[model samples]
Target: MNLFDLGWDDFASKSFHPFCSGDLVPARVALGHKHACELLSAHGELLAECTGRLLHETASHADLPAVGDWVAVRLRPDEPRAGPASRRRADIHAVLPRKTKFSRRAAGDDGGEQLLAANVDTVFLVTALDANYNLRRIERYLAVAWESGAQPVVVLNKSDLHPDPAAIRAAVESVAIGAPVVALSAAHDESVAALAPWLRPASTIALLGSSGVGKSTLVNRLLGEPRQPTGAVSDAVGKGRHTTTRRELLVTPSGALVIDTPGLRELQFWDVANDSLDSTFADIAALAARCRFGDCAHRSEPGCAVQAALEDGSLDADRWQSYQKLQREQAYAARKADPRLAREHGTAWRKIHRAQRMQQRLKSGE
Candidate 1:
């Protein structure tokens, strides 16, 4: 098979370096486990491990290859590394610079973001139209997708379970703003073709959603086989078991590479910048541009375009509020990174509140 047929273009674009040209063999990490990885090279599939030196010098989690990382590997002659003692163990010499990385804050207090996949061209934010459909949650996923630097496509899976798929699509489009939202049932073979545009060759797409949302089912449908198992949904909760335990890189017959990740129960925000947040909330940003003041906070600020739009029915209050909530979350997350800045912002807030109280007293003639 040609290199391009196995999703090589996307991975190579990120990790290939001129300096490493000729000396190293290129391989894409198909699956990453704690001990080793499954790598797909031009020659064939191989079981690989990082050199002890590479492991010793590793500074962060990102240093270790993740699913979809294009790595520079020190080739071992036909035989697999004999054992732990062998010096010829496949070593990850280096990782090519990534074109795009999809990440979310790791769950819990670590405060570190977990890299979900690297060099992804498209992110499929899957949401189901059954009892689990929640537009607000879709908005949250869009924020993370936009932040990942990949084009986001909202996939409304399990549409057959819902009588009004259009309503669910409209709800997703409401917050999606500029994203493409498609409704289909991954359980049904024909319905899965709706994702054809993104399933083209050389493209790398990752499926992300909460567990039991049919992420695996969708993956199996696209594969045209039961490569991934579908879990049975509970009769009471309408949620299925989390069938996918690890992230895997699967090559489709169409030559597209798809990464199926275990569903994310929580997506914490580590340090998403305002640009992504702005992109996710573009509608509010566009409305805010016409605010009377250059720095209108949109909270009772005279002629505040966002507030005006909300009152005049040009914008949805729920969406506007969601934008503000996400904005505050991003701002707080940023502040958490810098102690001095956090302190400064805390003091500023107090002073601003104090000044506002005084102004209110004067306006009330107290």
Candidate 2:
């Protein structure tokens, strides 16, 4: 595989110079496993594991190589090939700086960021048009996608099931801000042509969505073969069982690199900054600009544009609530990431609690 086909460019070449002089070769991580990874190098596909020094020096798991990451690898010439079943193995010495990355909070209470895919040019936020259609979920995805620095395209899959796919696409477009919404049945070849613009040659796109949203099916369709296993959605719950168990990058027949991820059951934002949040909710941000106060919270304040829109029905109540919920969550995650901010927040809350208790005692004549 050509390195450029995997999204490599001058930025990657510049970042790779530090390790280029040695036996190190630039490879893109095609599949990331717990202990090892499959990389696409100039020499072709090879299995590689991170060097002990690389693992020990890393501050967090997010620093490790992920699917779609470009890394400096050293091929082990002395080690004999394991067997016909496995490719030659190498050691990944370093990961180049990612121009874009999709990430979410790690599952459990760790409060750590989990890198999903790196160096992706576009993200396909797939959602089925059936019972799984959810604007709120799409909004959440848009937040992370915006934070990732990648262009987000909403793919309304299973369009054949809907009588008016255009209507559904319009609805998605309303809340999607300026992001493009493409409605197509991945099962149909003609309909899938709508996605060709984003699947440009040499660009990397990642498919992301919940279970039963047909991400794997879309990958298969794009590949023009059943390379990825797909599952059927349950009639009762409209949810499909997990089929793609791991994140893997593949080259589509169209000459574009694509990453197919396992359907995400939970997607929590991790370290998303306020600028990205505003970009995701650009509609609200625009309305907020008309408010009388620059610092207006848009709640019960006089001349508050957001609240006025909510009252007059110009803005959606559900979307406003979703925005608020995400804002609070992002704020909390930020506080968690910064110990000083968390301490200040706790102190402020304690002061408010004390003031409330004092007022209560005075009212009761205690």
lDDT of every model, 2 decimals: 0.78, 0.87
Summarize candidate 2's per-residue lDDT along 188-249 as a digit string, tens digits: 87888889998888899999999778888899889998877677432222243332234379
For candidate 2, the clash count comes to 0
How large is the C-alpha RMSD of every model relative to the true structure?
A: 5.5, 3.2
| TM-scores, one per candidate | 0.85, 0.92
lDDT of 2: 0.87
Best by lDDT: 2
State residue 309's C-alpha deviation in candidate 1, in Å. Answer: 1.5
lDDT of 1 by residue, 275-342 (tens): 89889988888888888999887899898888778888988888877777888878877786556888
